[model samples]
Target: MGMSDKMVTVLRRQFEPTVEMLKNLIEVCPDDFWFDAKHKYWKQIFHATTSMKFWFRQQKDEEFIIPDFGKDVTEDLDKECSDYPTKEEMKNYVEEISSVARKFFDELTDDKLLEPCVLYEEITRTDVILMQIRHVQHHIGYCNNILNSNHLEAAKWL
Candidate 1:
Protein backbone atom coordinates (compact mmCIF):
# COMPACT_ATOMS: atom_id res chain seq x y z
CA MET A 1 0.00 0.00 0.00
CA GLY A 2 1.04 3.59 -0.59
CA MET A 3 1.75 5.88 2.37
CA SER A 4 -1.65 7.53 2.12
CA ASP A 5 -3.30 4.13 1.87
CA LYS A 6 -1.47 2.94 4.96
CA MET A 7 -2.46 6.05 6.88
CA VAL A 8 -6.05 5.52 5.86
CA THR A 9 -5.92 1.98 7.17
CA VAL A 10 -4.39 3.14 10.41
CA LEU A 11 -7.02 5.82 10.87
CA ARG A 12 -9.80 3.31 10.28
CA ARG A 13 -8.26 0.97 12.81
CA GLN A 14 -8.04 3.83 15.31
CA PHE A 15 -11.45 5.44 14.84
CA GLU A 16 -13.89 2.69 13.86
CA PRO A 17 -13.34 0.40 16.82
CA THR A 18 -13.28 3.26 19.26
CA VAL A 19 -16.67 4.37 18.03
CA GLU A 20 -17.97 0.81 18.17
CA MET A 21 -16.81 0.52 21.74
CA LEU A 22 -18.58 3.75 22.53
CA LYS A 23 -21.77 2.40 20.99
CA ASN A 24 -21.52 -0.68 23.18
CA LEU A 25 -20.93 1.51 26.21
CA ILE A 26 -24.05 3.53 25.55
CA GLU A 27 -26.13 0.44 24.87
CA VAL A 28 -25.19 -1.30 28.10
CA CYS A 29 -24.93 1.67 30.46
CA PRO A 30 -27.52 1.41 33.22
CA ASP A 31 -30.34 3.92 33.21
CA ASP A 32 -29.47 5.08 36.70
CA PHE A 33 -25.88 5.73 35.75
CA TRP A 34 -26.56 7.18 32.33
CA PHE A 35 -27.04 10.69 33.66
CA ASP A 36 -24.86 10.48 36.75
CA ALA A 37 -22.94 13.76 36.86
CA LYS A 38 -19.77 12.09 37.99
CA HIS A 39 -19.54 9.79 34.96
CA LYS A 40 -22.25 10.84 32.58
CA TYR A 41 -22.02 8.41 29.64
CA TRP A 42 -23.81 10.75 27.27
CA LYS A 43 -21.58 13.68 28.04
CA GLN A 44 -18.44 11.63 27.68
CA ILE A 45 -19.59 10.38 24.32
CA PHE A 46 -20.59 13.90 23.33
CA HIS A 47 -17.17 15.26 24.12
CA ALA A 48 -15.46 12.48 22.19
CA THR A 49 -17.71 12.78 19.18
CA THR A 50 -17.59 16.54 19.13
CA SER A 51 -13.83 16.59 19.29
CA MET A 52 -13.56 13.98 16.58
CA LYS A 53 -16.01 15.89 14.40
CA PHE A 54 -14.29 19.19 14.94
CA TRP A 55 -10.68 18.19 14.47
CA PHE A 56 -11.51 15.84 11.64
CA ARG A 57 -12.72 18.79 9.61
CA GLN A 58 -10.15 21.18 8.21
CA GLN A 59 -12.03 24.25 9.35
CA LYS A 60 -11.16 27.36 11.29
CA ASP A 61 -12.27 27.86 14.90
CA GLU A 62 -14.65 30.59 13.78
CA GLU A 63 -16.28 28.14 11.36
CA PHE A 64 -16.78 25.48 13.98
CA ILE A 65 -20.05 25.44 15.89
CA ILE A 66 -19.59 24.18 19.42
CA PRO A 67 -22.21 21.77 20.62
CA ASP A 68 -24.79 22.97 23.13
CA PHE A 69 -23.16 21.43 26.19
CA GLY A 70 -19.57 21.56 24.94
CA LYS A 71 -16.91 23.43 26.86
CA ASP A 72 -14.61 25.33 24.57
CA VAL A 73 -13.25 27.90 27.00
CA THR A 74 -12.18 28.38 30.59
CA GLU A 75 -15.25 30.57 31.06
CA ASP A 76 -17.46 27.80 29.65
CA LEU A 77 -16.06 25.32 32.15
CA ASP A 78 -18.31 24.01 34.96
CA LYS A 79 -21.38 25.52 33.31
CA GLU A 80 -23.86 22.68 33.13
CA CYS A 81 -26.48 22.37 30.44
CA SER A 82 -29.64 20.33 30.94
CA ASP A 83 -30.14 19.36 27.33
CA TYR A 84 -28.04 16.23 26.89
CA PRO A 85 -29.22 14.31 23.86
CA THR A 86 -30.81 10.88 24.12
CA LYS A 87 -28.89 7.73 23.20
CA GLU A 88 -30.91 7.50 20.03
CA GLU A 89 -30.02 11.07 19.11
CA MET A 90 -26.37 10.46 19.76
CA LYS A 91 -26.44 7.21 17.82
CA ASN A 92 -27.33 9.25 14.76
CA TYR A 93 -24.52 11.62 15.66
CA VAL A 94 -22.11 8.73 15.98
CA GLU A 95 -23.18 7.46 12.59
CA GLU A 96 -22.92 10.90 11.01
CA ILE A 97 -19.40 11.39 12.29
CA SER A 98 -18.52 7.87 11.30
CA SER A 99 -19.44 8.79 7.76
CA VAL A 100 -17.46 12.00 7.92
CA ALA A 101 -14.38 10.21 9.20
CA ARG A 102 -14.74 7.58 6.54
CA LYS A 103 -14.89 10.19 3.82
CA PHE A 104 -11.84 11.93 5.20
CA PHE A 105 -9.78 8.78 5.11
CA ASP A 106 -11.25 7.63 1.84
CA GLU A 107 -10.13 10.82 0.15
CA LEU A 108 -6.86 11.28 1.98
CA THR A 109 -3.80 12.04 -0.12
CA ASP A 110 -0.15 12.14 0.89
CA ASP A 111 0.02 15.81 0.07
CA LYS A 112 -3.09 16.53 2.08
CA LEU A 113 -1.74 14.63 5.04
CA LEU A 114 1.52 16.62 4.93
CA GLU A 115 -0.13 20.01 4.39
CA PRO A 116 0.76 22.54 7.11
CA CYS A 117 -2.16 23.60 9.30
CA VAL A 118 -2.77 25.55 12.48
CA LEU A 119 -5.27 24.61 15.18
CA TYR A 120 -4.41 24.87 18.83
CA GLU A 121 -0.91 24.41 17.41
CA GLU A 122 0.97 24.46 14.17
CA ILE A 123 0.77 20.95 12.74
CA THR A 124 0.10 18.89 9.67
CA ARG A 125 -3.24 17.32 8.74
CA THR A 126 -1.65 14.00 9.65
CA ASP A 127 -0.85 15.24 13.15
CA VAL A 128 -4.36 16.61 13.58
CA ILE A 129 -5.95 13.26 12.75
CA LEU A 130 -3.62 11.36 15.03
CA MET A 131 -4.18 13.80 17.87
CA GLN A 132 -7.95 13.58 17.47
CA ILE A 133 -7.82 9.80 17.45
CA ARG A 134 -5.89 9.82 20.70
CA HIS A 135 -8.47 12.23 22.16
CA VAL A 136 -11.25 9.80 21.30
CA GLN A 137 -9.35 6.86 22.74
CA HIS A 138 -8.89 8.66 26.05
CA HIS A 139 -12.66 8.84 26.47
CA ILE A 140 -13.05 5.29 25.25
CA GLY A 141 -10.77 4.17 28.04
CA TYR A 142 -12.83 6.15 30.55
CA CYS A 143 -16.03 4.48 29.33
CA ASN A 144 -14.38 1.09 29.60
CA ASN A 145 -13.40 1.85 33.17
CA ILE A 146 -17.01 2.70 33.93
CA LEU A 147 -18.09 -0.59 32.36
CA ASN A 148 -15.58 -2.53 34.42
CA SER A 149 -16.75 -0.84 37.61
CA ASN A 150 -20.36 -1.70 36.78
CA HIS A 151 -19.57 -5.38 36.20
CA LEU A 152 -20.01 -5.03 32.47
CA GLU A 153 -17.82 -6.48 29.75
CA ALA A 154 -15.22 -4.07 28.51
CA ALA A 155 -15.05 -3.51 24.78
CA LYS A 156 -12.28 -5.32 22.96
CA TRP A 157 -10.04 -3.62 20.46
CA LEU A 158 -10.65 -4.58 16.88
Candidate 2:
Protein backbone atom coordinates (compact mmCIF):
# COMPACT_ATOMS: atom_id res chain seq x y z
CA MET A 1 0.00 0.00 0.00
CA GLY A 2 1.20 3.51 -0.82
CA MET A 3 0.96 6.70 1.20
CA SER A 4 -2.25 7.60 -0.61
CA ASP A 5 -3.78 4.33 0.45
CA LYS A 6 -2.58 4.85 3.98
CA MET A 7 -3.99 8.35 4.11
CA VAL A 8 -7.29 7.12 2.78
CA THR A 9 -7.36 4.32 5.33
CA VAL A 10 -6.79 6.83 8.10
CA LEU A 11 -9.43 9.11 6.67
CA ARG A 12 -11.89 6.24 6.44
CA ARG A 13 -11.25 5.38 10.06
CA GLN A 14 -12.08 8.91 11.22
CA PHE A 15 -15.41 8.74 9.39
CA GLU A 16 -16.84 5.79 11.35
CA PRO A 17 -16.80 7.46 14.76
CA THR A 18 -18.14 10.78 13.48
CA VAL A 19 -20.86 9.07 11.47
CA GLU A 20 -21.84 7.01 14.53
CA MET A 21 -22.11 10.21 16.49
CA LEU A 22 -24.18 11.76 13.71
CA LYS A 23 -26.58 8.82 13.47
CA ASN A 24 -27.00 8.87 17.23
CA LEU A 25 -27.91 12.53 17.04
CA ILE A 26 -30.49 11.67 14.39
CA GLU A 27 -31.91 8.92 16.59
CA VAL A 28 -32.08 11.08 19.70
CA CYS A 29 -33.65 14.14 18.06
CA PRO A 30 -37.28 14.52 19.13
CA ASP A 31 -39.79 14.19 16.30
CA ASP A 32 -41.21 17.63 17.05
CA PHE A 33 -37.74 19.13 16.95
CA TRP A 34 -36.92 17.14 13.82
CA PHE A 35 -39.14 19.34 11.69
CA ASP A 36 -38.64 22.46 13.78
CA ALA A 37 -37.93 25.20 11.24
CA LYS A 38 -36.91 27.53 14.04
CA HIS A 39 -33.75 25.56 14.83
CA LYS A 40 -33.54 23.76 11.49
CA TYR A 41 -32.23 20.67 13.31
CA TRP A 42 -32.90 18.21 10.53
CA LYS A 43 -31.63 20.72 8.02
CA GLN A 44 -28.32 20.84 9.84
CA ILE A 45 -27.68 17.17 9.06
CA PHE A 46 -29.12 17.67 5.59
CA HIS A 47 -26.67 20.47 4.96
CA ALA A 48 -23.76 18.36 6.14
CA THR A 49 -24.60 15.49 3.77
CA THR A 50 -25.21 17.75 0.78
CA SER A 51 -21.92 19.48 1.46
CA MET A 52 -20.10 16.14 1.35
CA LYS A 53 -21.59 15.43 -2.06
CA PHE A 54 -20.37 18.77 -3.37
CA TRP A 55 -16.83 18.55 -2.00
CA PHE A 56 -16.40 14.85 -2.79
CA ARG A 57 -17.42 15.48 -6.40
CA GLN A 58 -15.15 18.51 -6.58
CA GLN A 59 -17.77 20.26 -8.64
CA LYS A 60 -18.25 23.96 -9.19
CA ASP A 61 -21.39 25.53 -7.67
CA GLU A 62 -23.11 25.63 -11.05
CA GLU A 63 -22.12 22.03 -11.69
CA PHE A 64 -23.35 20.71 -8.36
CA ILE A 65 -26.88 19.39 -8.55
CA ILE A 66 -28.75 19.03 -5.30
CA PRO A 67 -29.31 15.30 -4.82
CA ASP A 68 -32.79 13.86 -5.34
CA PHE A 69 -33.24 13.71 -1.58
CA GLY A 70 -32.49 17.41 -1.33
CA LYS A 71 -34.30 18.98 -4.25
CA ASP A 72 -34.55 22.76 -3.90
CA VAL A 73 -32.88 22.53 -0.49
CA THR A 74 -30.50 25.42 -0.09
CA GLU A 75 -27.73 25.71 2.51
CA ASP A 76 -29.11 28.73 4.32
CA LEU A 77 -29.07 27.83 8.01
CA ASP A 78 -31.40 30.68 8.98
CA LYS A 79 -34.01 29.66 6.39
CA GLU A 80 -36.55 26.84 6.71
CA CYS A 81 -36.47 23.94 4.27
CA SER A 82 -38.83 23.76 1.33
CA ASP A 83 -38.58 19.99 1.44
CA TYR A 84 -38.03 19.02 5.04
CA PRO A 85 -36.19 15.69 4.99
CA THR A 86 -36.91 12.96 7.50
CA LYS A 87 -34.33 11.29 9.74
CA GLU A 88 -34.46 8.07 7.69
CA GLU A 89 -33.83 10.07 4.53
CA MET A 90 -30.94 11.93 6.11
CA LYS A 91 -29.44 8.65 7.41
CA ASN A 92 -29.66 7.07 3.98
CA TYR A 93 -28.12 10.16 2.43
CA VAL A 94 -25.28 10.08 4.92
CA GLU A 95 -24.58 6.46 4.04
CA GLU A 96 -24.64 7.32 0.35
CA ILE A 97 -22.11 10.08 0.89
CA SER A 98 -19.91 7.71 2.89
CA SER A 99 -19.93 5.14 0.07
CA VAL A 100 -19.05 7.76 -2.55
CA ALA A 101 -16.34 9.26 -0.38
CA ARG A 102 -14.65 5.87 -0.21
CA LYS A 103 -14.67 5.71 -4.01
CA PHE A 104 -13.21 9.21 -4.20
CA PHE A 105 -10.49 8.26 -1.77
CA ASP A 106 -9.74 5.01 -3.60
CA GLU A 107 -9.23 6.97 -6.79
CA LEU A 108 -7.01 9.54 -5.10
CA THR A 109 -3.26 9.55 -5.44
CA ASP A 110 -0.69 11.20 -3.17
CA ASP A 111 0.02 13.67 -5.97
CA LYS A 112 -3.64 14.46 -6.51
CA LEU A 113 -4.19 14.83 -2.78
CA LEU A 114 -1.50 17.50 -2.70
CA GLU A 115 -2.88 19.33 -5.74
CA PRO A 116 -4.83 22.54 -5.25
CA CYS A 117 -8.51 22.08 -4.40
CA VAL A 118 -10.90 22.94 -7.23
CA LEU A 119 -12.92 25.47 -5.24
CA TYR A 120 -10.28 26.83 -2.90
CA GLU A 121 -7.08 27.54 -4.75
CA GLU A 122 -5.40 28.22 -1.44
CA ILE A 123 -5.84 24.66 -0.14
CA THR A 124 -5.06 21.14 -1.36
CA ARG A 125 -7.49 18.28 -1.84
CA THR A 126 -6.26 16.66 1.37
CA ASP A 127 -6.78 19.91 3.21
CA VAL A 128 -10.36 20.07 1.89
CA ILE A 129 -11.12 16.56 3.15
CA LEU A 130 -9.76 17.31 6.59
CA MET A 131 -11.64 20.59 6.73
CA GLN A 132 -14.87 18.95 5.58
CA ILE A 133 -14.56 16.24 8.23
CA ARG A 134 -14.14 18.96 10.79
CA HIS A 135 -17.10 20.74 9.21
CA VAL A 136 -19.25 17.64 9.81
CA GLN A 137 -18.16 17.56 13.42
CA HIS A 138 -18.94 21.27 13.65
CA HIS A 139 -22.54 20.73 12.61
CA ILE A 140 -22.76 17.82 15.01
CA GLY A 141 -21.87 20.38 17.65
CA TYR A 142 -24.69 22.62 16.42
CA CYS A 143 -27.20 19.80 16.69
CA ASN A 144 -25.74 18.78 20.01
CA ASN A 145 -26.21 22.29 21.32
CA ILE A 146 -29.90 22.03 20.54
CA LEU A 147 -30.14 18.71 22.32
CA ASN A 148 -28.22 20.00 25.33
CA SER A 149 -30.33 23.15 25.59
CA ASN A 150 -33.51 21.08 25.57
CA HIS A 151 -32.14 18.89 28.38
CA LEU A 152 -32.02 16.04 25.89
CA GLU A 153 -28.98 13.87 26.19
CA ALA A 154 -26.49 14.47 23.41
CA ALA A 155 -25.03 11.54 21.50
CA LYS A 156 -22.02 10.00 23.14
CA TRP A 157 -18.60 10.44 21.55
CA LEU A 158 -18.11 7.26 19.62
Candidate 3:
Protein backbone atom coordinates (compact mmCIF):
# COMPACT_ATOMS: atom_id res chain seq x y z
CA MET A 1 0.00 0.00 0.00
CA GLY A 2 1.04 3.57 -0.55
CA MET A 3 2.23 5.69 2.36
CA SER A 4 -0.97 7.74 2.37
CA ASP A 5 -3.09 4.61 2.25
CA LYS A 6 -1.16 3.10 5.12
CA MET A 7 -1.61 6.24 7.17
CA VAL A 8 -5.34 6.30 6.49
CA THR A 9 -5.66 2.66 7.48
CA VAL A 10 -3.79 3.22 10.70
CA LEU A 11 -5.87 6.30 11.50
CA ARG A 12 -9.09 4.39 10.92
CA ARG A 13 -8.03 1.48 13.10
CA GLN A 14 -6.90 3.79 15.88
CA PHE A 15 -10.08 5.90 15.79
CA GLU A 16 -12.58 3.03 15.80
CA PRO A 17 -11.75 1.90 19.30
CA THR A 18 -11.35 5.46 20.41
CA VAL A 19 -14.86 6.29 19.28
CA GLU A 20 -16.21 3.38 21.28
CA MET A 21 -14.22 4.35 24.32
CA LEU A 22 -15.46 7.90 24.25
CA LYS A 23 -19.04 6.79 23.89
CA ASN A 24 -18.67 4.39 26.77
CA LEU A 25 -17.16 7.11 28.90
CA ILE A 26 -19.96 9.56 28.25
CA GLU A 27 -22.51 6.86 28.89
CA VAL A 28 -21.08 6.08 32.30
CA CYS A 29 -20.02 9.45 33.67
CA PRO A 30 -22.38 11.86 35.32
CA ASP A 31 -22.96 15.25 33.71
CA ASP A 32 -21.68 16.95 36.83
CA PHE A 33 -18.34 15.23 36.51
CA TRP A 34 -17.85 16.75 33.07
CA PHE A 35 -17.89 20.21 34.63
CA ASP A 36 -15.94 19.33 37.73
CA ALA A 37 -12.99 21.71 38.06
CA LYS A 38 -10.80 18.92 39.34
CA HIS A 39 -11.31 16.75 36.26
CA LYS A 40 -12.40 19.04 33.43
CA TYR A 41 -12.74 15.96 31.24
CA TRP A 42 -15.13 17.57 28.80
CA LYS A 43 -12.89 20.56 28.27
CA GLN A 44 -9.96 18.31 27.55
CA ILE A 45 -12.03 16.39 25.02
CA PHE A 46 -13.01 19.61 23.31
CA HIS A 47 -9.41 20.77 23.06
CA ALA A 48 -8.29 17.40 21.73
CA THR A 49 -10.97 17.40 19.03
CA THR A 50 -10.13 20.96 18.05
CA SER A 51 -6.46 20.10 17.79
CA MET A 52 -7.24 17.07 15.65
CA LYS A 53 -9.24 19.30 13.34
CA PHE A 54 -6.26 21.55 12.87
CA TRP A 55 -3.80 18.70 12.27
CA PHE A 56 -6.07 16.90 9.81
CA ARG A 57 -6.15 20.05 7.68
CA GLN A 58 -2.41 19.87 7.13
CA GLN A 59 -0.90 18.69 3.84
CA LYS A 60 1.96 16.26 3.76
CA ASP A 61 5.23 18.20 4.11
CA GLU A 62 3.26 21.27 5.11
CA GLU A 63 4.02 23.03 8.36
CA PHE A 64 1.27 22.41 10.86
CA ILE A 65 -0.81 25.47 11.73
CA ILE A 66 -1.52 25.83 15.39
CA PRO A 67 -5.17 26.48 16.04
CA ASP A 68 -6.34 29.68 17.73
CA PHE A 69 -7.64 28.67 21.10
CA GLY A 70 -9.46 31.96 21.32
CA LYS A 71 -12.61 32.94 23.16
CA ASP A 72 -15.01 31.63 20.53
CA VAL A 73 -14.02 27.98 20.85
CA THR A 74 -13.72 28.05 24.62
CA GLU A 75 -16.79 30.18 25.26
CA ASP A 76 -19.14 27.97 23.30
CA LEU A 77 -17.64 24.91 24.95
CA ASP A 78 -18.08 26.33 28.40
CA LYS A 79 -21.78 27.05 28.12
CA GLU A 80 -23.71 24.76 30.39
CA CYS A 81 -26.57 22.83 28.87
CA SER A 82 -29.48 21.33 30.76
CA ASP A 83 -28.65 18.06 29.08
CA TYR A 84 -25.17 16.97 28.11
CA PRO A 85 -24.46 15.89 24.54
CA THR A 86 -20.95 14.68 25.14
CA LYS A 87 -21.05 11.51 23.04
CA GLU A 88 -22.90 13.03 20.13
CA GLU A 89 -20.73 16.11 20.17
CA MET A 90 -17.56 14.05 20.19
CA LYS A 91 -18.86 11.83 17.36
CA ASN A 92 -19.54 14.85 15.21
CA TYR A 93 -16.15 16.30 16.00
CA VAL A 94 -14.51 13.03 15.01
CA GLU A 95 -16.48 12.92 11.78
CA GLU A 96 -15.30 16.39 10.83
CA ILE A 97 -11.68 15.48 11.60
CA SER A 98 -12.04 12.25 9.60
CA SER A 99 -13.24 14.17 6.56
CA VAL A 100 -10.17 16.35 6.70
CA ALA A 101 -7.97 13.29 7.14
CA ARG A 102 -9.51 11.67 4.05
CA LYS A 103 -8.84 14.75 1.96
CA PHE A 104 -5.27 15.02 3.22
CA PHE A 105 -4.47 11.34 2.69
CA ASP A 106 -5.98 11.30 -0.76
CA GLU A 107 -3.79 14.16 -1.88
CA LEU A 108 -0.56 12.97 -0.26
CA THR A 109 2.28 11.47 -2.30
CA ASP A 110 4.97 9.17 -0.89
CA ASP A 111 7.68 11.74 -1.45
CA LYS A 112 5.64 14.35 0.35
CA LEU A 113 5.57 12.21 3.47
CA LEU A 114 9.37 12.29 3.58
CA GLU A 115 9.64 16.01 2.94
CA PRO A 116 10.61 18.02 6.01
CA CYS A 117 8.17 20.50 7.47
CA VAL A 118 8.35 22.21 10.83
CA LEU A 119 5.69 21.91 13.51
CA TYR A 120 5.82 24.54 16.27
CA GLU A 121 9.25 25.64 14.98
CA GLU A 122 10.88 22.70 16.70
CA ILE A 123 8.99 19.50 15.87
CA THR A 124 8.69 18.04 12.37
CA ARG A 125 5.46 17.25 10.53
CA THR A 126 6.17 13.54 10.92
CA ASP A 127 6.50 13.98 14.66
CA VAL A 128 3.39 16.21 14.84
CA ILE A 129 1.07 13.61 13.35
CA LEU A 130 2.45 10.92 15.62
CA MET A 131 2.00 13.21 18.59
CA GLN A 132 -1.58 14.00 17.57
CA ILE A 133 -2.47 10.31 17.60
CA ARG A 134 -0.76 9.84 20.93
CA HIS A 135 -2.58 12.86 22.37
CA VAL A 136 -5.96 11.41 21.46
CA GLN A 137 -5.04 8.08 23.01
CA HIS A 138 -3.93 9.80 26.18
CA HIS A 139 -7.29 11.52 26.52
CA ILE A 140 -9.07 8.25 25.84
CA GLY A 141 -7.11 6.65 28.64
CA TYR A 142 -8.14 9.46 30.95
CA CYS A 143 -11.79 8.99 30.03
CA ASN A 144 -11.53 5.29 30.82
CA ASN A 145 -10.00 6.10 34.17
CA ILE A 146 -12.81 8.51 34.98
CA LEU A 147 -15.41 5.86 34.19
CA ASN A 148 -13.62 3.28 36.29
CA SER A 149 -13.36 5.68 39.19
CA ASN A 150 -17.11 6.20 39.07
CA HIS A 151 -17.67 2.43 39.22
CA LEU A 152 -19.46 2.66 35.90
CA GLU A 153 -19.05 -0.05 33.30
CA ALA A 154 -18.63 0.85 29.68
CA ALA A 155 -20.65 -0.98 27.07
CA LYS A 156 -18.88 -3.63 25.02
CA TRP A 157 -18.95 -2.84 21.33
CA LEU A 158 -17.70 -6.19 20.12
Each prediction's TM-score against the native? 0.78, 0.82, 0.62
In angstroms, the error of model 2 at 99 is 1.4
Lowest-sum lDDT 10-residue window in model 1: 68-77
- For model 2, give the 10-residue run with minimal summed lDDT: 66-75
Q: Write the per-residue lDDT of candidate 3 for residues 1-158, one digit (tens) a residue.
A: 37446754664566556545554555666777865756656655766766766666554465654333322235134554333335456556556665765665555554555545333545544555666767766776776677677785643442
- The lowest-lDDT stretch of 10 consecutive residues in candidate 3 is 66-75
Candidate number with greatest lDDT? 2
Error of 1 at 49 (Å): 0.5
- TM-score of the candidate numbered 2? 0.82
- Error of model 1, residue 10, in angstroms: 2.8
Backbone clashes, each candidate: 0, 0, 0
Most TM-score-accurate candidate: 2
lDDT of 1 at 79: 56
TM-score order of candidates, top first: 2, 1, 3
Instruction: Sort every candidate by lDDT, greatest first.
Output: 2, 1, 3
- Residue ranges of candidate 2 with Cα displaced over 4 Å: 1-4, 58-63, 68-73, 118-121
Error of 1 at 37 (Å): 2.3
Greater-TM-score candidate between 2 and 3: 2
* lDDT for each candidate structure: 0.69, 0.77, 0.57
- lDDT by residue (tens digit), candidate 2, 74-95: 5667665566777788788788
Better of 1 and 2 by TM-score: 2
